[model samples]
Target: MSLIHALQSALGENAVLTQQADRARYEQDWRGLVNNPSLAVILPKTTAQVAEAVKLCAAHGARIVPQGGNTGLVAGAVPILGPDQVILSFSRLRAVRDVDLLSDTITVEAGLTLATVQQEAVKANRFFPVSLAAEGTAEIGGVISTNAGGLQVLSYGNMRAQVLGLEVVLADGTIWHGLSGLRKDNTGYDLKQLFIGSEGTLGLVTAATLRLYPPVATRASALVGIENIEQGLGIFTSIRHAAGNALTLCEFCTQPALSLGAAHTPNGRLPFIAPAYLLLEISALEGARDPREMLETVLMEALEKGRVLDAAIAQSERERLDFLALREAISEGELREGGAVKHDIAVSLSRLPALVRAVEDLVARTYPSLRPNIFGHVGDGNLHVNIRPPAGQTMADIANHKAAITRDVESLAISMQGSFSAEHGIGQLRLLGMAAHKSQTDLALMRAVKQALDPEGRLNPGKTIPES
Candidate 1:
């Protein structure tokens, strides 16, 4: 039987889509930037089925692209064009296998959305802190592949930190089920970690045992107008020290970003006109001192010291969500404008000001026709400094400068001792950036690991690790 027939036999015909129309949505990325059509998309409902599909593909030396929510920004989940690769989508593997409240772990199939997992935890009066704008659609598999870091990374870490155990299907179809809820397994060489940020080059993550925490009993939120991004950083540092782990979030946004949010978001307008703004949040257990009063006191001091220009605190959950809407609406706001050169970069907390300054200098020197939508999780030193041209400037104009602009932006991050791919992984989008910016030694090590795992590059080929 042919590969299609074989896949159809293993997983029903409905699960294996071969026609162009059936594979259309899978081909194009969520951002509409990349569209790499695969020979077929095989949807597996269980780990055993995934293993069988991999075994079938391995026999024919066919490459397989493992995809989850398909909401990735770096195009890693999308298949490489012209490879005749098969897309192994885990959309059907949406099962919560186990939940151990005492161990503070939840074992779930990789296809479960982050929002679903968070809701499950909420039902149990626990919390899962790995969150992002794409939480509604992004699955655990893709999240694990990218090692995604989101707003709560300052308090709880990224996907890499949240994973307690993982079950992965090897390139040769062997299942490595290490789903132990143990907090510490002094075992040699924690193999599960290899697939955490491997972006599916190493293996296909079928499921994961993730860490959970006590649900926050009290919360407070504020949207503060800042004199500048640097002042936003200052405010973040002070709050971090004063509130410690209670400081849940400190998201920074530039004037242009606020303008975009104000213009596009229907309800919330930028309350004050300033160089920058911060959407800050603090949360604590019920027994602890009131988080609202603590946040208010900190903001009062910040205001007195000129670290903050203006502030609007959220006294209710509705008001808190309204404040958060401004931060969450940034991507949509940028999209409403037009094409953009986007970068997610990170640096030391102390040098965030330097990174911002460098970005400003780069824009002044090269992109006079564009506006910078500077925003990100400032608490963790990650910033998404994207450049968007005005309506008058054509996309062709933006395209012409995109390559140079991206290089300049990556160069700035390199000079500041920061990283170019902060939360986003080196999927197809950042492959060139990886080659251009990553050191020879780092590339060699990554290549070696890839070779060791998938020797023929039969899994997610031409991504993550750049060729030598």
Candidate 2:
């Protein structure tokens, strides 16, 4: 029997998709960037099935692109090698394998959506802090593979910090079961980490043991209007100094971006107009002081010091979700208006203002037809600065300038000792950035690791790492 027949035999025919309609759902990326067809899309329901599929693909000398939820911004989860590769989708492999409350960890199959994982943790009266707008559909495996960071990184850190252990299937179909929930295991090399952010290039992550935290007993959220990025950063500093880890989130948004987000608000109005806005949140275990009170005090001080122009503290849970809705809607709003030349760049907290200023200057000096929609996890120094085209002009109008715009913005981030790709992993999109921005030593070491783990390049070819 051939590979398709073998896959169908190993995993029921329903699990093996060969028709264009069956494979179409997994073909296009979240951004609709690539829609390359594949030879087959394998839906594995268990680790054994995943291993079997990998083994069969290896035997046939066919490449496999591991995907989860198909919700990646960088087109990392989609295939690019024409009709030769097969997609090993973990959608049916979702299962709550184990939940260790004592260890404060949850082991879940690769296909469990991030939101589902969060809900599972909540069912156990625990908290899983890796959150992003895509949490509703983005899977745990994809998040682990991308090492995604979101609003909460200000306090909890990225996906890397939350992963305690991982169960990975090697490129050659060997199952490396390293799902240990122990927080401290000073064993050999911490091999599980090698596959965490490898973008499915090194190995296929079948399941993961993720860290959990005590449920938030008290929480608070606020949206404050500020005069400029400096004022917004100042407010972030004060909140961090005062609340410490209680400050679970601190997001910055430009006025233009806020306008876009506000359009999605229930009232369809800007919360309170200003040059910039800061949407922040605080959470803590039950304590004498309410988190809302703590947030109020910090904002009061900023207001008294002229750092804050106007502010709205979430008075209830509904209001808090409303506040978050605005921040979350910013990206959708931008897309509705017409997508911009987007860049995910990061710098030190102190240099964020300078980076924003430099980008503004670059746009002003050249490409006068574009406006900036800058916003992100400012507390962690990551910003999604998208330069939008002037009203009525779509991305096509600015097509000629997109390359130069991305180059200059990325180069500015590098000049500030920042990264060109911050939270979003180097999927096929940023491979050019990797070749352009990554140092020689960095590329060589990355290639060495890739060679050791995936010698034949049979796993997710033409992604993450550029050709040497």
Q: Which candidate leads in lDDT?
A: 2
User: lDDT tens digits, residues 1-468, model 1?
Assistant: 788888899989999999999998887777778887788999999999999999999876689999989888788888787667999999999999998988888999999999999999998899999888889999999999999998889898899999989999999999998887888889699888899999999999999999999999989999999887778877887788879999988899888787777777677777678878899999898798888888788899988887789898997998888777778778877766675778999888888888898888878877776787799988888999898886677456678788888899988888888999899888888988899988899899988988898898899988988777
* TM-scores for all predictions: 0.98, 0.98
lDDT of 2 by residue, 73-122 (tens): 78898999553799999888789999998989999999999999999999
Report the Cα lDDT for residue 435, model 1. 92
Overall local distance difference test of candidate 1 = 0.87
> Which residue pairs show backbone clashes in model 1?
none
Runs of candidate 2 exceeding 4 Å displacement = 265-268
Worst 10 contiguous positions by lDDT, candidate 1: 390-399
- Residue 381 lDDT in candidate 1: 88
Tell me the deviation in Å of residue 92 in model 1: 0.6
Q: Where does the lowest 10-residue lDDT sum fall in candidate 2? A: 264-273
